[model samples]
Target: MTTSLGPMAPGDIRTRAQIRQEFGGSPQGGICPSDEKKSVNLYSDPSIGEHVGYYDGWLAEEDELGPVFEYTGAGLTGDQTFDGPFGMGNRSILRHAEQGRKLRVFIRAGTIKGTATATHRYVGTFNLDQRLPYVWRKVRGENGEVRSVIVFRLRPDGAFKSSAADTIPAAKKTTVEFVQFQPITASMLNSGPATQGALSLPSQRQGAKSSARKRTTNASTEGVFVVSEAFNTEMSLRAATAASIAVRREAALTKSYRAHLEAAGHTVGAFQIRVEGLSSTLRTDLYDATSHVLYEAKGSSSREDVRMAIGQLLDYSRYVKTDAHPHEPRQAILLPAAPDPDIRVLLERHQIGLVHQLSDGQFTGPDFTAPS
Candidate 1:
């Protein structure tokens, strides 16, 4: 339901030898005749008789030409030589190259756009010491030079401005700031149940620290199974239940389940039934360790009516102390039975997981923490 998007990442420090080798054609900033026999660095002022002219000299062409700011930034196309550091075009540009054994930086970009709109990820350097998505990517030249590019979709302050949608949809929109990352102290692999494909959570940055909302409710049903009202919240959860039941009854067979769930994104609550020899309830109810919808049983044949079975009941879980058994980290038993097929799918779509069974029962099991 909710899509998560963030800002671009920063680049790293590169050596001189790396820049010269990979750099192709003219300079990235359109300054030198990289394609010519004897390329010149036009950034030098002829009058000053030196290299590196007035740092701000290139911005004069904005009135007639734009590369300036349009809506989606679709214009401003010209030869590399036309928009170099000497011209200072409105668009943000950076140059990375090697001169002898040394490296160079061309910081020729504009200020952060006014408001947050879209988000992109860039790889480079960073200083995530803030409350918003902010990181920098070091653009690299052909060989291997570190070209700095400040990566931040939008600082928290950007929310105050009006958006391009208010205008002709042509105004430059900034990206929304989402990740204010703290340094990461752990290096752990992703190990949860696999869907069609495995998931790889973001790696922790060195020394960065941030506490995410850890989802842990391990114990399962341990009382009488109670069937609740029916709900059709999501299709995936329904699909999971149907598939699980089929698997138990030798019906839902598949090497990978993610593909099945993704392909079965047809409706919120759909129940299918078979009579004579086969049966399946194409619905979901139970949730897995990762909050994804677990499989539900297929509805039975004509002779057997579709039944919503209850597993276990817990008079209470709030008073159950997990610390009593220090070794056992995941305390699974909870008062609520696994949600019906509909709710599970909706939660799973959002990266939530569960530890309940589809059918209600007097269930019991050892609670374990989700993999690190």
Candidate 2:
């Protein structure tokens, strides 16, 4: 990894927009210098969320290490879970070290007590600490649900720390409301790095061997990569909760389900479809285009989870599209384990299907009658 330049200089502090404008980048695509890779990626945390409230500021404060801040990954609707070295925002920042660049962070420290346009303060440019690099913290999301989010622990490269007077001005409170603001907006998701595509199964399997299992690395056929369900959940939770546990369990269940379907010669993948009233698109967890079956995956088979998945699949089935038709796909819930008999009976009554993982990691079912 390349050596970091150090904490941002006092005079280098600037709003995310100003930094991007001068550096030639967008809120989504990430900022960089005029030269392809010379500039730093600026992360703006306004500390706003519908459920989580103004959390980024507090998380940044808890850090006793000088100039150290826990900057979150991008994704406003859910928890921002890191997807190895392939995710955007936080993961992208790590690349700066390899590419010989820097990551500058800014936090919204509302200058006035009750105002939202409060100018941001420059925290500093930091490098990820190889040890204890990240932690799963509980955070709120737009839906008011709490979930785990990956917060990267970054340390200042050189001797520098923003004074309390500079980091948080006098007369200003430490808390801020979760408000819709610039640099951190809905459109920002659309502006994510072109290289950071959504996770999905490759259209063509490398081999027909049932034992072949690997992470999907190829970009979509159109060269577009949309974020996967796990990462999406991470981004969403990041915006809502303040604490959560390991996210890999949830991701593993989904991957296991997807892999099982593929090995059986059923093409399975996450598909993006437009919802009737929503501006942004909704992605299905596992869409079998050929069979017109849509699956919603849950890490657990508890009643609460099964109920939630049922509702989501029903909602998605109504407005989702396939084969250029607004055909209601056969809806099913995929779980890590089977739910109670009552839950199964309830699902049968509704004609919603149930698929569960067996002890051996194999997926079974869609075992209910399809809704007529």
Candidate 3:
């Protein structure tokens, strides 16, 4: 609300961290700053089964979800409008997430000139993780950089245009535009504004009641605030695969283990096979619409390891708290065996051991009940 953005002031141009702390949150609780966002309960809440890969190890929701906004605090002075190769004007989202200042300021580019080039026929899309009603983010852009960042709160009168389009013609050589677009990490799901976003549910319900019966009933809770299930599926399955290899060479394939994790992940959200939850940097979630079971890699062969992973599974289930999908049965998979210390402990303590820290490859449990 205030201005004079030199470093970052409270209510002026607060970072994601500042907003979180101001309301009600902590730093040490979440898996990481970026991952620890509110809304989705995370690994810490004993009930949530947060895996090692997610922000706080919380499972990714598999159902259809509404828009979830992502505000970046990796401040850049100018506006590539995004965090690029260099960390210029490098503004960290939050310093001490514990202070409860873990909230990203929305972009309010409405006050400034519009750069997006939108025509009647051609319309490019920007990532609308969050559908803010009256907020805009301001950032300075160089040839391809971020600068002079500022945020403003205002109402939009239906005047939004798509920015410049990136045209990549059929390339002669393999060209991969390594744009580091941060996926809603586990931390953000567990601790970031997501939970805070939950408070809006009742109002969301009341508004739904005003609509037609079909629309009102459907609007209450089914798809009001759902995230992309497809994205969650891809990310979470990836986490399970990594854990499968880490706990043991082939723990992921054991029919019993795979079945357990398969059922558990779908219902619970994630497998709590690791203490830090799932691997943030590495993960893949797979979802079967027909079967409706989410599978996770359980590396340890010993019952103790499987039990730990089970406990983590229970954790995620508990936090979902609501019996939103009671019919769904989730699970964790622990099979095979490994020799790494982290892997061993994960198996012994949390039941997450299937993973190859150095590489993105893995094997299923001895039974080879490969994931779907």
**Which is the leading candidate under lDDT?**
2
> How do the residues 1-372 of candidate 3 rate in per-residue lDDT, one tens digit apiece?
344435433124333344344333333232133434332111122112111111111011111222122223233233322233332112122112222323322222122235432111111111111212111122224334423221211111121221111111111221111122223333433334221221111111111111111111111111011112223211211113333234223322433333443454432122211113111111112222223333443444455555555564554333221224435333334344443454456544643324222223344332223332
Q: Is candidate 1 or candidate 2 better by lDDT?
A: 2
Q: Each prediction's Cα RMSD?
A: 24.2, 17.0, 18.7
What digit string (tens of lDDT, one per residue) describes model 1 on residues 13-109? 2222122233322433223323332221222122221111111111111221111111110112221111224222211211111111101121212
Single out the weakest 10-residue window by summed lDDT for candidate 2.
Answer: 173-182
Error of 2 at 114 (Å): 33
lDDT of each: 0.21, 0.47, 0.26
lDDT of 1: 0.21
TM-score of each: 0.16, 0.43, 0.24
The parts of candidate 2 lying over 4 Å away from their true place are 1-40, 43-91, 94-246, 273-281, 324-326, 367-372
- The sequence of per-residue lDDT tens digits that candidate 2 reaches over residues 1-372 is 111234335334454555555444455432232235355655454445324522332221222232334455555545553353224455455445544555555555444356443444554546554322444444446667655454555556543334332221111111111111111222333444312222211112121212112122322221111224333222221112111221334556776766565556654455544222221224456666446677887767789888878888887676445434346778888788889999999999998888888898776785322222
Model 1, residue 91: displacement in angstroms? 22
The candidate maximizing TM-score is 2
For the record, the alpha-carbon RMSD of candidate 2 to the native fold, in angstroms, is: 17.0
Q: Which scores higher on lDDT, 1 or 3? A: 3
Ranking by TM-score: 2, 3, 1
